[model samples]
Target: MSFLDKMFASIGIGAAKVDTILANDRLVAGDEVNGRIVIQGGKIDQDVDDIYLKVMTSYEQEIDDKKVHKECVVGKFRLTERFTIKAKEKREVPFSFELPIDTPISYGKTRVWVETGLDIKNAIDPSDRDYIEVHPSPLMSKVFNAVTDLGFRLREVECEAAPFHARRRLPFVQEFEFVPTKGEFRGRLDELEIIFLETNRNYLELLIQVDRKARSIGGLLSEMLNLDETNLRLTITNDNAHNIKDMLYQVIKKYS
Candidate 1:
């Protein structure tokens, strides 16, 4: 017998097997995941002590000039079901659990994946990994579309490691980079970095970093603005080459 077979035999599992089945094939953050554990016994009866379920995620982190592996336990459960399995007998146990809302999107189309596993004592552990596509909230999509409609095209999107204090409920921040397509500030500015906070009460917080190009005389100027201000005003100009034409007009008009 192989070493694994010997180990299984020592655990009193002559030929035990474990399988997991989910009620739905797809899941989203904040959704309940329901499934069943199927256990098939071998030639000898075995006493099961405990069962455990764990949810894990694999992500990359930069450490000391190199990328390293980081695995986190998002969730875990200690099952209370205990029983004795007769020779050649089968048993099934049902389980239901909730997925956390703050789960990070790790795949395309804002999707996140979760790996679920069953730890069967004295036997080999069985696990399953699946993808969950996260649909952007209506408010989120609205704000995104609004920015695009304002002549800003998306240049890049990424998740930041640091948590921002402007809004709550986010352990990781998502940044969207855009280039101006029209208006007075077009070529004058490099790109805009935008961060969206949590959606609440039909409103969302937009954090913007405006990068200004260097002037011919050799000095560069950049500014950060908070979009939540009510009294803030800017003139809307139709200059196609200047992306921040409207902003510049407003500033110039205010000073004049």
Candidate 2:
């Protein structure tokens, strides 16, 4: 290789480029993701040490009393071992992986993407990012429908820092917030916050926080101190999806 060509490749000029194309961008959590990595050789041959795919998303956390956004990887997959791409050559590698059950859904400010990168020794790595739409799983859909049917409107959805004890495999948890607009709990409760603690093909575990409205002076004082919120865990299986509305109603009613 010419000295100039080597210098250019080192800075990513005329270097191999990578692009990942998914079979379908719209997917549900716990589903399989199929895709292929396409690499186009540039002006010179290069040795690719490895190829990787990472499922990434971002969450907000309070740092020094200020909200900061940071990225996190949900999963990672290796596609290929050491390989060489000749000048002006093109290559495609197939890949498939199970989308994590706890992958954050594409809702509100949350976004999920797949990052493809090629590792080249002594050369700048070429990378590509493709965003995907992640929908709720079957059991999660049931719970969301139940809440909407009860006249609770979705207020906001966000991924936030999770306390150490409450965290699972991730450092943060996705939270779904709702407010009663015209239901029996409208005046009794201020809001309802739901967190999917654990999910699988068979069942889902949720952490529900019920915030009650202040009634008496003592109640107002407790609310002012952020002590009027009740936290509870609920587990629902496929068989219980049909009655999820009633199941959730009773729990909220008890606290409201």
Error of 1 at 254 (Å): 12
The root-mean-square deviation over C-alpha atoms between each candidate and the true structure, in angstroms, is 8.3, 0.8
Candidate number with greatest TM-score: 2
Per-prediction TM-score? 0.60, 0.98
lDDT of 1 by residue, 8-28 (tens): 655645765666677874655
Local distance difference test scores for all models: 0.55, 0.94
TM-score of candidate 2 against the unseen true structure: 0.98
Error of 1 at 85 (Å): 5.6
lDDT for residue 195 in candidate 1, whole number 0-100: 63
The count of residue-pair clashes in candidate 2 stands at 0
What is the C-alpha lDDT profile of model 2 across 134-235, one tens digit per residue?
Answer: 999888999999999888999999999998988999999999999999979888889999999999988999999999999999999999999999999999
- Candidate 2 residue spans exceeding 4 A from truth: none
- Give the number of the best model, judged by lDDT: 2
Superposition-based RMSD of candidate 2 using all C-alpha atoms, in angstroms: 0.8
